[model samples]
Target: MRRLPMSLLRVLWVATAMFASGSALAASCAWPDWDHFRQNTVSADGRVIDASTPEQVTVSEGQAYALFFALVANDRATFDRLLNWTQNNLAQGDLTQHLPAWHWGRREAKPGDTTPSWGVLDSNPASDADIWIAYTLLEAGRLWHERSYTALGTVLARSIVAKETAMLPGLGRTVLPGPVGFHPQDDAWRLNPSYVPLQVMHHLASALPEQPEWKAMLDSSAKLVTGTAPHGYSPDWVIYRSGKGFGPDEATKAESAYNAIRVYLWAGMLAADAPGRAAALDAFRPLADFVAAHGFPPERVDTQTGTPGSNAGNAGFSVAVAPYLAALGRSDLAQAQVQRSRSLATQSPLGYYSQVLVLFGLGYLDGLYRFDADGAVVPAWTSTCPAPR
Candidate 1:
């Protein structure tokens, strides 16, 4: 080929270099929330620690969430590490055989022993965490082409159905908080709304179409969510007694607080075409109105009385409600919440639950991830660049 003019050659070289830099930047996109969480929350060995607790606890919920954030960020090595830690420490060395224990922490010193031990603090499994872990694994399998993960996830999901679910008199198939303690009486079954995220339930159902119970659970979850929040505010816990229907949980006195906040977040992040999306949004509209009028969500609300708590919710609460407000067509209010959350984030660090809320709400709003109508995760990395090898 004939040599180009010197100036033309120089221009072409600069354009090519810039294009390469842009491509690299796109390929290595950073999610600031995920980065912060990984740095502050996750250990080198993949344990997600909450140092504030006496046990220096590692909750199954934290591990499950880290697995999800890892997949979203396309950090496969980190995902594997987290999963290994969960399987070895929480699941008794095999997730396929045992649901991960809910808590791993320091044991209290015995009467004669000078030191305490560190191990599974509570062997009872948390169903919500189990569901999240299974859901994330299934999605990771699809998104990353990991058939092992898909197999492991399938086993766990089936195990959850067999162990953690009960067919109530009115509800077809409902997830208990765990394998035990939820069914205190023959006639009564206590349930938690936060534990019944429809998106994850639908995703399980969609991923495992051969399992009929997943579909039934999805429909029952909708009924549970919509039915329990009769006054537009979800309670942290409710008791469903045969013939009596849903009632206030004596443990919580029917207050909507920390756990119930996730109910709003889950409902808000649901795809537009999700089943029962309309009823869920309408059932929870008062929350949007409350935030709009008060400039902040209440720290607590009485589901039965429709009373707001005196104090504003925590910093994470601001971001947690952003998606809900936006879904309700209150973009102005949503923007306000987003600004508040960011401002608080600059001031100080929040607790684990708050941080998780911030991640879910802001990450979804910022287009880092989304859920499809059938509940498959749509992490931005999948389309923004090629999958990380």
Candidate 2:
């Protein structure tokens, strides 16, 4: 047992210190849950399948969400795979030229086909999913310094404005659910409040200032979210008449259910300094109070009557409302919801949609990312790994 030379000892010490620093850096940037989500829900070819259905359909929404989660996790490989699969399978091989079809996967093609076929089930584009994809690509471009991502995001954003939005008589320019079917009548158009998250619009406006419609969309969305929910709850869909303004969509019976739940989640996740933060919170205050009183969100609510169905919201709902509750300064209530979410996640695993809500809500609450005043993403990575000059 001989003592090492002084120079050798100093070199070993430096190497050990460097190793520790590198390990810490890696840990700080890791997002293991996202990896788990990819393993469980996404396929090798990048299709995100919702296994709850027997048909195992892959939706544009699923792909969009995976892309966002991948970006957040800083997994460029997964991000590229997800984007490529979406463009090839859903958007006819080019995202810039085509809005990805909403639904694709296995389904019976004809009345008597023995073997089910795999392809695009519906050619319609869901604006919500489209926005998320575009936002992720744009932010990825900025964060990762990838010109290709930025270019694709710019084209997709412009395409969304062109195809998915329309000029409502009194509402100004508004985002329709898609390019078609939303406007069943000449003077009336259907809109989904959940389809346009204010934060996403803000990001788009900041990313694409030349596109005036993005700012108009932000203004109109704030009006719609606050004006439509007279009873402090958002409806899944609503109709706007040329002169009448906002009203419940007859088809949905004014129910605030799955789609509407995201309204509170998005409102809560907004940066404290984000534009219209105060008004958006004020508009959604009743929901915060409801969760505080009830210990969980209602599975369904009558938007006109403020009456909630008996069933309690699942873990996903608890997670979605947690950020909103915290935003309203009810940290205790928010913590309660967080605990409830943990318990629920333990009892039953989250499905695709619930997982998305949890990721958005809890990620913000955990300080993973924040939207700036202008709506661009401020990811944790910026602090960990600054861009090159």
Candidate 3:
């Protein structure tokens, strides 16, 4: 065989190298769904509003999740906007001194007030959102090499521990649903199992090892997540008795609804080898089984009776459960969920909650990022792109 000219070989080699580099960059930097979400759901000031309704309210949860998405996309500008908005509007301009309020929106004009006022509707801070916000900030600091982000995250995490966690009789350090109203009585506390994502707890622990409560909270979080789902479906809220442990909360009628849907999503998004992955997946197996058998999730389920309501869960449910199914090696069922999510997204515009769920579950399945065993974010860009100059 005749050899190619040296000049031609060099050109081919350079072209191949460029193509490989471009492919890696594309894999790392590509996030079309995030672009859509930013354009449709997020405001210029970085508030993630629920446009499905007329209120145009912003929740701390929305802001927190958006911050995480922005971090994964490596969009520092958007992340900063979100943080600044949260601090200024929700936390009274000082995150270090106060937990951000959970709700902010326009209110009706009061006596002597002509124009409607827009501000914090509820000053009560949601611990779930608080934790997620801290996690994102910490990860951003590490990934972006910004000390300010890390310091802010550390302060937020410390505040969460101080105000939102309790040392339960049997459960050790447990996370409360919010700063108030969760403690209904002296002997009991209301807790949302879905409020504490294990990965978030783990990440915080890894980041702030000095705070022993973070590690202890991880153990309690695992127990809370698994023990509450006795029949393999998580409850929206549960009450922790001083000595008896978890039981369904009276307020929610033992129904597993929208809030509990995230339990499966969190489990599904765990690194395949992450700690508690097996037990977590096993605990929520019934949800996976239900989706596999019914072709969709139930809109609501009686956790005590295991009777599913007539209404089917939306595309968000399918999307949220997809990663868990995939993690369980049920690729076929997982793919079905993805297709259902796509079909639902095309049928009509997804609301804020559904859109967030889809972004998280599908984003994980698509290799956008992964939470390491220690709960640190490992975005694809880590391997594809060099550090910022």
Candidate 4:
């Protein structure tokens, strides 16, 4: 049965490859920095979202690669364009084997390519890319009422979640395969245990709650992530199946802060609504505090010495702190964190992560929803956990 599905998926991939050929189009606008971007495009508030003309810029193949900007700036038009582009381009590949990794340029690049590669499926699927793209596509579908995107997005999310989890052998977090699995660059035969999927699962649960299986997956994911952490310092990398810990790797450890922050913050947020919210929140608090003090996290930590080791820069990590702070109801702290992150990001020229942080920070600052000064949820999105009226 698995083989049959894979074969069918492969055929679909080949068929889609026909249209996948091409370099990326330019972004319609010139968002040199967050400030300039905000001035020209986004209003201080949430109601007025603007997009730079497509003539101004072109997005890459990956859903999130460009969609990040769209989401942060709250530019529905550009976001829609990028999402459509992802559905049309990246989502064309094999449903079973090598999924669509997004391409960054006119020529869709895969991981390890000189240029920024399409984040779509690479030789093998990277869990983060798969989940992020799926999440974004679903959001796009909901925002735009695009049935095709919604359907495809749901399929993508399900396919990746099922395929990857099935390959694993026990009750554990879904780790990115080290060898020919998801990200081959890191460990050849290990699981790149990451926190990104937790976020993905949360979104999935909310997006597709009717499906008992989806809910089960989310429950499984929450258990695995929150359960596996040692004092909430969830090691960035874990050897596959064997359950051995592998710290961060060279490919993108500097971004550890960026990724880890999501795990902690999302875990904390979800715990407030999860049935086992108390324990999860307890675990996340320590990790969050550690990050706040360290300023950075390593891809691989010296377990013996408890020291940090990572290869990426401060850009990714810095940008992540703001949201985490805000989520914890420390808006003042969140703003402070955002300022520091923005400063570090600015020093690194133009990168997607920093741009995203600035835009999202601005969004939070603008009081997009009904968040208070402390970033508390006065009456935000309702959780499965009941809130007092």
**How well is each residue in 120-224 modelled by candidate 3, as lDDT tens digits?**
888999999999999998888887777888899999999999999988898899899887898899889998888988888888887898788999999999998
- Residues 1-389 of candidate 2 have per-residue lDDT tens digits of 99999999997887675443322233235555566788988999899999988779999998998898787766777889999999999999989899999999897769888888898989999999999999998888877777888899999999999999998877788988999899988988988888888888888877788998998998898888878998899998888889889888889889999999998888887888888888888987778778878899998988888788999989889988888889899999999998998898998888888887877877777766777777777766556642221
TM-score of each: 0.91, 0.90, 0.91, 0.59
Q: What is the lDDT of residue 152 in candidate 4?
A: 71
- Candidate 2: stretches off by over 4 Å: 1-28, 109-115, 384-389
| 2 against 4, candidate with superior TM-score | 2
List candidate 1 stretches off by more than 4 Å. 1-28, 111-115, 385-389
Question: What's the C-alpha lDDT at position 44 in model 4?
Answer: 35
Each model's Cα RMSD:
5.6, 5.6, 6.3, 14.2
Cα error of candidate 3 at position 12, Å: 24
Report lDDT (Cα) of residue 337, candidate 3. 89
| Model 4 error, position 266 (Å) | 3.7
lDDT of each: 0.87, 0.85, 0.87, 0.46
Better of 1 and 2 by TM-score: 1
Worst lDDT 10-window in candidate 2: 19-28
Q: Which stretches of candidate 3 lie over 4 Å from their true place?
A: 1-28, 385-389
